[model samples]
Target chain A: MSDSPDSAKKKILLIDDEPFITSLMAMNLEDSGRYEVREQNDSLKALETIMDFVPDLVVLDVMMPDLDGADIIYRLKNDARLKHIAVVFHTATVREAELHAHGGIISGFPFLAKPATTDQMIEFIEKHLPK
Target chain B: MNSVPPDSPPPAQSTLQQLEEGGALSQFASSIAHEVCNPLSQIVLATDLLAGPQPMTDEFRKKIITFLRQGADRIEKAMKSMLQTCAPIETSMVAEDANVLIETALASLTVDASVRVEKHFASDLSSILIDKKHMTEAVAAIFANALDAMQPSGGTLTITTYAKVFTSSEREGWQRQSWFRAGDHAVVIEIADTGHGIHKSQMPLIFEAFYTTKVAGKGAGLGLTVAKKVVDLHHGRLEIDNRPEGGVLAVLTLKSAAKPATFLSQPLP
Candidate 1:
């Protein structure tokens, strides 16, 4: 990742249960050298990782075991400090509209589907993140 | 069996009898379909209500919708099974790999993760001429039965296929006619499940229509029946035998449609 002496590089967290998919994403994103990519498979430790890593963008999966992505979005959106950090939901879930209509305002800033391409994820981050 | 009398109250009477029989079967199937569809409609309605733009703090609505979708799929399958049993199967022939078909069916099932699935297939085997949908349904039913036998509590499921030659001795009284010669080539597909083995007494009637060991609403006891019908439609023989290890083995023997060839060798032990 390209980081200036004065500013840190943008960090992206990719959370998903499927190992093959997440590893593929992490490899692709890390190889890009534009953004630092971190992966979390454990849903329970997701919030802790977010707090510790302080990622610029969070990529969340929906069909996780303990906690779902939508619920995590709700929690993140409710927190004052984390609210500013852009969350991009990535899941194989059946319904996307309901997640978008969280109390008339979508909690997750952007949503993406599973098996997403490299260009799509980067475009989402670029569009949503502050300059 | 008594044949229809020659007088037969004219051809119209026979036509009327056939029509009545067909109508009765259709009505019975439609009634079952209606019963299944009513609850499905309710689930859809419930989802619509839950998805209303109104505010709700709890997230149980999504869970309920998922449950309803699963329930609706199961019921839809049951109704289709019943309807299939009452009608003659219509098959469309295609070149299909048996191993691939079995794997696809297994993947689509909502089986328990604990159950072990093992596949032993002959890679050099020729493509079989069969209807993909009916074959898939038949394989899925057998797999579902195996899963039911081994889920929550785990067990191994083995699927194997190979070429074989059958004799009258092998079929015995099961064959309606002795059409088999000494060297009739056939393909055998075996599905073995390690559930609670079938009791000795229930063995004879397990595949009979309307005979089920499952409780009410859990199953209509038609899985094996429909499976057998599909096999028969494919000009195949469905055989069931108790496994030595404590389970059931369902073997389907389909006449080889590929070029005729002698048996290469018995599978390695």
Candidate 2:
């Protein structure tokens, strides 16, 4: 999959309002060594970071202080360049039952619950990584 | 030294109690400030400690993580409650069974082991149109009050619901019970507790905004007020009163769904 030097590790962008959640998740993702993760504690700055970093996958929080995960997804879906980038919603607000009710995904993006085990996150990360 | 008469009544007061329209905002901010900040502090402390880790066992790590999550959940609760007090943003209503709602509300509660809930739901009870989340919070407010009151004594909490056809005379019993139109059918729910009842003097003030008998931090005194507003939004009536013998009883009556009480052919949730 990695035909180029820069596309070696999967690039990840984590957006959440809570510093603890973003900071801890970033540390955990980077520690896995398969991901190059960048954390944004403010949801408002998501667009700027996404433009600059151009992540392969985005992990967004559903309920945030400024803009929610759905808002970010809308932005991603509209842009021509970013529309194809994979997205996974990570939230405590929306439950698995609710997710399934909406057809196993939110706006065509897979989701993982907050407080997910590191293993569970790893599996999700791997499934969405570029092949 | 001036010795006032022990039995002398207090100074004259206004008969009509008026809560300043904006009083709740300051009180809400005051309470929520602590609620949000404390959790943030815990998360910060735990993350800082867990950082530059030098020898932390899995158990310790789990304990810290638990604290962080719990704090986050508490912050969510406080903010949610505060938001509910403001006004309804958008209410998504659907036909839902009251029994299910009661169960959802009870499940939402973090009741102590000492508290127990007993349900007596009429099998033929009709469904009601409600926004699931808002209704759950409204019902859970009463359930939580009962739990908080009975936590020390470990008493039984009884919840009962039934379909009631309102007669004109019965409608007269409740002032402005228009939520259930006269001669229309409605769903009635009663939640009662074996805990000590509210004081006779305090009963009148119980639902007043920011009026609470609980010490600071235990509650913001907005539960009943928010519950009342949500019930009103649903075109329902909310009542809180003392039981004849002992305890507190909260009754909620809502307009039943248009359809008659019948199970779905395929059983939908």
lDDT score of model 1?
0.63
Please list the C-alpha lDDT of all candidates, in the order they appear. Answer: 0.63, 0.69
Per-candidate TM-scores read 0.46, 0.47
- Model 1: per-residue Cα lDDT over A1-114, one tens digit each: 343332455788887654444555665555556677789877778888888888988887754534557667777778887878777776543233334545635442566654
**Cα interface RMSD of each candidate:** 17.7, 10.7
DockQ of 2: 0.02
lDDT of 1 by residue, B1-269 (tens): 11222321111122123325434444334335433543443354345445444354467556556656765765677666665565555566665667777887887798677888788887666555667788888878878877887755888899998876665434533434324456666677899988887777567656654445552245656777677656655557778888998888988776665533222454556
Candidate 2, residue B41: the lDDT equals 46
After superposing candidate 1 on the true structure, give the runs of residues whose Cα lies further than 4 Å from its correct spot: A1-131, B1-81, B167-179, B260-269
Chain A TM-score by candidate, in order: 0.81, 0.83
Per-residue lDDT for B145 in model 2?
A: 83
Q: Please tell me which predicted candidate would have the highest lDDT against the true structure.
A: 2
Lowest lDDT 10-mer window, candidate 1 chain B? B7-16
Q: Each predicted complex: what DockQ?
A: 0.01, 0.02
TM-score, model 2, chain B versus true chain B: 0.66
